[model samples]
Target: MRNYLIAGIAMAATFATTPAFAKDVIVQMKNQGAAGAMVFEPAFIQAMPGDTVKFVPTDKSHSAQTIAAMLPAGVAPVIGKPNQEMSIKVDKPGIYGIECKPHTSMGMVALIQVGKGPSANLGAARTVKLPPLAAKRMTPLLAKAR
Candidate 1:
């Protein structure tokens, strides 16, 4: 009986930790040095609710911030500075637009599509139109391959 109880407890622990090990996608925000504006690689990412998304900075003076009212309540990310990383565990099914505060006007915005419902296209289907300035700066960055 003692051995059986121990085995059961172990199994329970494993089950409890299984969900926490789900795969995470690491997205990068490129700083572009001084040639151009920073840009998020892929420009858009698709993730399931509960999945973790890590934003890594690839240049200096760059940061990630979720535009107010762009994400559902409780889904906003905690903004951080360059070289620093920020993570968000998407818990709701919807589209989110994230940008670098100072660069948004220069097209430093990207999209995050969470959960499986409706369209999943990050740009064409659920476009988060950016300001002309922001879009212009992002043009060059978007052309480079990851």
Candidate 2:
């Protein structure tokens, strides 16, 4: 019984010292009728693994989706429907590219950086194709990490 009690205390200590709990980050997809006005607020975000990202559409006609080609090899794809709240749990450490399908041409894209250090597949992520404006907008955002 004494051994079991000690083991219980050790386990409890382990949990207590660990990084608390996961958090949720919100991303808003805003729509503006004017060309180039539709975009994602805070186009770049840094998060930890196991965090949740909730994509909210703050205006008419917008959707958030993962850019498949830009995701880490093993990560799952996410595609959010218009005007609906979509939540995604991030379990990988890497950069994730998000886009608003209808507005991608107008630079409606975002990026999420999870965890620390570097991900194994960053090379693959850079290969993703984006619209002219999207690519232009992401250039500085991506460079900020370096």
Candidate 3:
């Protein structure tokens, strides 16, 4: 009976001390064909600690690389080629920046903000805001080129 009681206590302790794995978020990189540049859609992402962020490439020639020391400790993203997916598990709460090696100057960049809550701000501030152009007037002009 004593052995059974001890076993039960051990099992309960194990269950209580186990850590939970992080959840995954998906991010995609796209190529718009304007140039040989990698573009990250939505540019900014937010998550909590222990969350995993997966980077998916939609461009054939682009890859992702995490900026060293940009992220919190233990939060380094896996970087790879196009059509390949990599993930970063955020253990600490902070902002992280990722960029494509081939097109870092062409704006192939993204940012992830991880924290205890959903209040952390990630990504660089937008510097330019173009006025909304009339799509109806622009469509005919663009169509003529095609």
lDDT (tens digit, per residue) of candidate 2 on 2-46? 999999999999886555677889987887533348877778888
Model 1 lDDT tens row, 51-83: 877878776666787765456555555676756
lDDT of each: 0.65, 0.80, 0.58
lDDT of 3: 0.58
- Report how far off residue 53 is in candidate 3 (Å): 0.6
Q: Which candidate number has the best TM-score?
A: 2
**Preferred candidate (TM-score higher): 1 or 2:** 2
- Alpha carbon lDDT of residue 53, candidate 3? 79
Best by lDDT: 2
Query: In candidate 1, residue 67 scores what lDDT?
Result: 61
Give the candidate order by descending TM-score: 2, 1, 3
- Candidate 3 ranges beyond 4 A from true positions: 1-21, 33-37, 73-78, 116-146
Give the TM-score comparing model 1 with the true structure, all chains together: 0.64
In angstroms, the error of model 2 at 29 is 1.0
Off by over 4 Å in 1: 1-21, 33-36, 73-77, 119-130, 135-146
